[model samples]
Target: MIPIDLQILKYIFMEKPIYYFKMKPYFQTSEYHDLCMYITNRSDTQNSDRLDKRDYTVFDLETTGFLPEIGHEILSIGAVRMNGNSEKLDEMHQLIKPIRPVPNHILSLTNLSRDALNQAPSFLEGFQRFLTFSENSTLVAHPAHFDVRFLRAMVKRWKLPEYSPPCIDSQQMAKYALPDVSHRLDPLLHYFNIHSLERHHALNDANMTADLFSELLLIMKKEHNITTYSVLQQLLNRQKS
Candidate 1:
């Protein structure tokens, strides 16, 4: 056998053992400190940036049924992205195949059936396309709570991350902007003289919603000079509160 020191040297050279040690509390604490610093910096950056009015992707969905649970699913989604100037940027209309069969009542209501959606894409696929088409813009919908709830459930079902962007509800906005008149879409559309070529269809409803939003904005600007996103957000928050 070799000398002890020599044997030790041979073992060190041959094995090159990696000694694992628990990180000390101080070192582990610094990781949290670093994360906090990162978050602070990010928040500061976000706060320092100037806010601008953004385009909105107005959308509507026709579903197999009213309830999100109990196997109700979206049959079609229609969307149109409108710029700050109220010009349409991109549009999408897609049919979705529901996991459950379309009931006869629903089929009659939406004119969508199992056979009609046989070749259509799934909700996950269609929603992904809508996200891409929307392109970081805000979402607009009439009676938004209803549509948002359905969309949120669908997004959760597909394991999609939460949507962080803002959403504008023309219904509530109209309540604030035109309190004197009925807030229903049809009546509001008629009030603004917005023609609805087709009713109940997702695309046509989305188009009508987009038009109504534009008209409402114009009326707000002309009457109240409300033209900023921050102001709109504040007003919406106040209404909610």
Candidate 2:
């Protein structure tokens, strides 16, 4: 008959018990298990840090006018995603047809005439495409309030649920990151050494915003150590309050 100690050891090793055996030996008698355990624990801690990365989408809208209450509508919407460290992913851009005619003043500003929008889909269709492309990612915009207001209005008109995704306003970020300077997009781009190409186009503006946001995120990460979504949300709430 097997010795009682050996039998207990065999049962602990071979029974495949329901609960984990923390005291079980993990290495051969000739090897050290403490080093292995330390390595495993360190790997787990590193993986936990990696899991806290952030995801964001930088976007821009070219509108037919300024105020939504005064019948302004979005003419085009463009966006690009960024992973934890501000690495950009694929981009999305769509031209939208407004419910009302494009005014001469808007045409002069945006250079998008009625004929250009004639071939495009309606605002609802364009917004649906944009939403699908975004895949529920957090949004970043230069002046978030205007773009968010327009998007919220479109969603409401289409009877869709409200979009409550996390948002980062580059304008606000600029104010916080560079307290002494003007917070306009062009100036911020210049400060970050991001070149501005097509000034008023939706896609170009979106790309520029992405670059600016990337630089701003690097700054935030280095200075504030903002590595998690909850921390970012708290900072934004504090800014709002």
Candidate 3:
């Protein structure tokens, strides 16, 4: 029979546990500690946290396919940090190795080959890096409902602590700002007079989405008087209802 100490050592070395996740006693290193705190401590009553005063992480994900529920996995993540509406701060782009084979259409759409992604980091590593880059910032995505759902699905699958940050859907915001205009990213790019980037590639999509979000913010401020985060969230909540 295996001794207790031997069993513990086997779990540590042979079983391959997530260092910070399950090994809390040996190493109490929670990588997501600050991110969780920031989101948790955010005051619902802070009405003065205006849109222009906040920092944002505008992000895009290129996945094998939609529907994370069916095992469609993320292939890449790209993001850019921005202060307020316009000032771009930093960027992060990382490829994630997926367990399943990449589909042909996805390859064409994202311009990512399996060979390229085989050399990339695993999903856990890539996600951790993304969280670090996005720490303490409100998250913005063109269609945040879809993007954020994928994020939540993956976080749950990985057994990581739940991360529910304040998220803004730029597409939804665009709908409110310009009721007559098409809300899709391509159309909005043309509408905003922003130069087009390579579509579907994660980083390029993120960069383009950042531009779209900035344009939407300016329009919202002028047309809707949505100058603060509270006002914007209220607008979004109202739209939902």
Q: Which candidate is the best by TM-score?
A: 3
Model 2 quality (TM-score): 0.75
Once fitted onto the true fold, the runs of candidate 2 whose alpha carbons sit more than 4 angstroms away are: 1-52
Models sorted by TM-score, best on top:
3, 1, 2
Whichever of 2 and 3 has more TM-score, that candidate is 3
Screening candidate 2 with a backbone cut-off below 3 angstroms (N, C-alpha, C), the clashing residue pairs are none
Q: Per-residue lDDT for 158-219 in model 3, tens only?
A: 55666687889998898888888998999999998999988998899999999889988888
lDDT for each of the candidates?
A: 0.72, 0.68, 0.80
| Cα error of candidate 1 at position 68, Å | 1.1
Worst 10 residues of 1 by lDDT: 42-51
Lowest summed lDDT window (length 10), candidate 3? 19-28
In the predicted model 3, the residue pairs found to clash are: none
- In terms of lDDT, model 1 sits at 0.72
lDDT of 1 by residue, 1-241 (tens): 3565664564356422321021123234554354334323421112211122577889999986665633357899999888767898878899987765577877787777678798897665676577667755778899888888888876554444554446778898899988999999999989989987677789999999999999888877788778776677788789978
- The reply for model 1, stretches above 4 Å from the true place, is 1-53
Candidate 1 Cα deviation (angstroms), residue 221: 1.5
